[model samples]
Target: MNIAVIGTGYVGLVTGLCLAQVGHYVTCIDIDTNKIDQLQKGHSPIYEEGLDKLLRENRQQKRIEFTTDYDMGLADKQMILLAVGTPQKNDGSADLGALFSACRAIAEHLSTDVIVVTKSTVPIGTNERIQDYIKQHAVNNNAVSVVSVPEFLRQGSAVQDTFHGDRIVIGGENTEAVETVAEVYQPFNIPIIKTDLRSAEMIKYASNAFLAAKISFINEVANLCERAGANIDDVSRGVGMDKRIGNHFLKAGTGYGGSCFPKDLSAIIAYGRKVEQPLSILECVQRVNEKQMDILAGKVSKRFRGLKGITIAVLGLSFKPNTDDMRNAPSIPLIQKLIENGANINAFDPAATETAKTLLSDKVFYYETIDGALKGADCSIIITDWKEIIDYPIKLFKKHLARPIIFDGRNCFSLKIMKENGMEYYSIGRPAIFPIS
Candidate 1:
């Protein structure tokens, strides 16, 4: 398969490199010459595990290329995947300026019969809109077929997710186009979900909504467990043992913070309003997640009275481990609230320190090591569950901190361990443990 993936961001770069890894000749096209130049040197502009190595190896194998020329990139390509970003607007609707512009360029450049598959998350009827829009603008109006194939790759484990995802959904009204898109993934041997274009678009939004709902639901349960004197760990384990509900996303934590869930859920609610249908449940899900971000902050403010003139050690910055993405990370609002209350903050993350600087600026102190952040701090707050933070010995807090209090957001440490170590621990939906002193 000779394929051109447009817009070399997260989705575009991953899709292009992964497809090329499977013996397909893939060319990633982007308008940014700097980004194209970086890829040409076997460098990935964004941080993703295994991406640079795979991209370099594939380039060496003559299977993949990168370009800024639309005509040269789109020419002679059998499949053109629209992997651009559809960022959310203030009203929660997706801004389609990038998608529309790419379609116009594809219309102008496409030369042969091609299946134009959308790998981006788009609203219902977007595929049809693209098809109609391209026909109106494409010189070869009769030769393009649009298919909807939304991506379900998780950030930290995108490479594994691409090769190991349980199913792949490829939808279109055109039978030939749909199968051609499906055949693109035939090498992976995943289950094929054949459906109409609208259903495929809805599936992506619905999946993100349900997962977001699950995180919020567990946080709610954790809150109830705290009030009722029940153990969330035990409750979640018992609940997950049932055949119906698996254990994924059952962990009681601060909340989900990343690009997909927040934006997709908001977009769905906006789409529902645009269609004159109400999505109250999704709206509530968003509300709950928003409040969950501040749970630790509330705990800190209530316990410490004013937090003025206090130095607090903070751990973790990125939304998840193995990636440096800080979009919608819970640490942002929590830290901002603490700073607003006049608390001095010291933070550390294994991978997110530099990225955190962009979002947080010089408002907080960044530490080279976890111990440095905790040194002379009154308390430690664990935000992201990076392995370095999790594996750090509990006694280090007693040695390094001015006080041994830890307001843990991710529940990475066991309650038993905290109690045994005589460390003060406060976590979501769990019983608070106080220092033995």
Candidate 2:
């Protein structure tokens, strides 16, 4: 199969590489010359575990190529996967500027009947709208068929998810269009969920909204546990034992943050609003998450009696570990609040500091080493549970900082260990751990 993947962001890059690894010749197109150049030189612009290696292998085997040329990418391609970003707008609707641009380019360049499969997360009726848009602008009305094939890949583990995802959702207007799209994924042997176009788009948004709701619901439970002297870890485990819940996204923390959840949840709510049916629960989920993002900040302020002039060491800057994505990362709000309260910030993440610099600028100090970031810090905050941070030498916390006050957002450490280590530890839905007198 000859596949053209538009956009070289995490989704497009991973999709292209993984598809090619499965024996499809893929041409990845991106408008950014720098990104294309980097891809051409065997470098992935985005940091994804196991991505660059696979990309190199695929490029070496001539199974994958990178280009900015739409003509080259679209030429003789049987399937054109639209992996472009459908960024969220102010009202929480998807900003389909990139998606529409890709459609127009596809319409102009498509010379044969091609399956235009969308991997971008768009609105429920977006595929229908796309079909209409292409028909309006295409050189030949019969040359294209729009199919909604929303991607379910996670950010850090997208490559693995592509090959081993539980299922794939495909929606199209006709049997030929949907089947052709399914044939591409037939080799993966994953379950294929075939639905109409609207339902397929809703599945993508609904899945994300439900997961985001779970995170928010757990965070709310954590808040209750904190007040009620209950441990969320214990609660999560006991609850997870039930076959009904099965314990995915049940961990209570500083809340869910990333490109997908925030955007997709909001998009669904926006969709509901546009159709005159408000998703009250999902709306509250978004609100709960926004508050959860600032939970650490609030803790810091309350603990330090107004963090004015306090030097705080923040461990972890990425939203989640194993990737450099900073979009909607809880650390952003925590760091912003710390700064607002006049706290001097020193933050460290193994992979996301450089990317964080773009969003956070010089507002916060960046440290290469966690110990370096902790050195001379008045108190420490853990925002992300990176493996290195989780496995960081506990004794060093006692040695490096001026005071051994640690606010852990992810609950990545054992409460017993923090207590035994003689640090004043604060975490979500757990009893505060203080040194034994």
Candidate 3:
């Protein structure tokens, strides 16, 4: 297969590289000259585990290439994948400006018969809209087949997810077009599901919504456990033992954040309103997640009576581990609220420091090491639970902080460990530990 993937963002880059890994000749197209130049030099712009290694290997094998030229990139390609970002608008509907612009360019540049597959998360009926838009703008009356094939790769472990995905979905009205897209994934040997274009789009939204609902539901349970003096770990384990509700996304933490959940929930809720079918459950889910981040901040504020003159050490800034993405990261709002109350913050993350500096306030002190962030701080807060933060010595929190206290949003430490260390610890859905002096 000879493929061209437009928009070299997370999805686009991963898709192009992985397809080339599976023996396809791939050309990654992007409008950003600097990003293309970086890729051309065998460097990846994003921090995804195993992605950079794959990019370098594929470039060495001559199986993948990067370019900013639309005509050259689209020429002689059997399939063109639209992996552009459809960012959420203020009104909660998806802003399809980037997607539409890409289609126009692709339609104008396309020279021969090609299958156009959308690997981006889009609203229902979006693939049909793309089909119509492409046909209208195509300079030459060449046959174009648009297929809906939304990606299901997780950010941190995208490479693993790609090769081990449980199922692959292909949706289109044209039988030959749908099968052709399936053939692209035949190398992976994953199960394939064929459905209509609208159903495929709905599957992506529904999957994100349900996963978001699980996180919110567990967080609510964690809150109830705290009031009732029950342990969330035990509760979740017992509840998740049932085969019907497997234990994925059941951890009680600072809610779900990333590029996916928040945006998808808002988009679907808005669509529900447009169709006169209110998604009341999802609306409540959204409300619960919005308040989850405040739980840790409230705990910190109550402990100190006020945040005035407080210096807090914040560990982990990215939405999750193994990725440098900070979009909708819970740490942003938590830090903002603490700062608004006059608290100073020192933060550190293995991969997110550079990206976080752009999003966080200039008042924040970014650190190269966890000890640097923790040294002399009033107390510590665990936001993302990266491996380094979890494995960090317990005595260091005691040795560095002005007061040996921790407010764990991710529940990274066990109660016994904190109690044995003689440290004050507060965590979600767990009993607070205060050692006897």
Off by over 4 Å in 2: none
Q: 1-437 in candidate 2: lDDT tens per residue?
A: 99999998999999999999989999999999999999899889998888978988998999999999998889999889999998899988899999999999998997877889899999888888998898898987556788988899998898899999999999987889899888889989999999899899888888888888889999999999999999999999999889999899999999888898998888888889989999999999999999888888888888889989999999999999998999988888778888988999998999998989999848699999999999999989998889999999889988999999999999989998987799999999898887777
Q: What TM-score does model 1 achieve against the real structure?
A: 0.97
User: Lowest lDDT 10-mer window, candidate 2?
Assistant: 137-146
Query: In model 2, what lDDT does residue 59 have?
Result: 88
Best model number under TM-score: 3
Q: How accurate is candidate 2 locally (lDDT)?
A: 0.91
Misplaced by over 4 Å in model 3 are: none
**Higher-ranked by TM-score: 1 or 3:** 3
Return the lDDT, model 3, position 315: 98
Per-model TM-score on C-alpha atoms: 0.97, 0.98, 0.99
Q: Rank the candidates by lDDT, best first.
A: 3, 2, 1
Residue pairs with clashing backbones, model 2: none
lDDT of 2 at 263: 87
lDDT by residue (58-96, candidate 1, tens digit) is 999999999999988988999999999898899898888
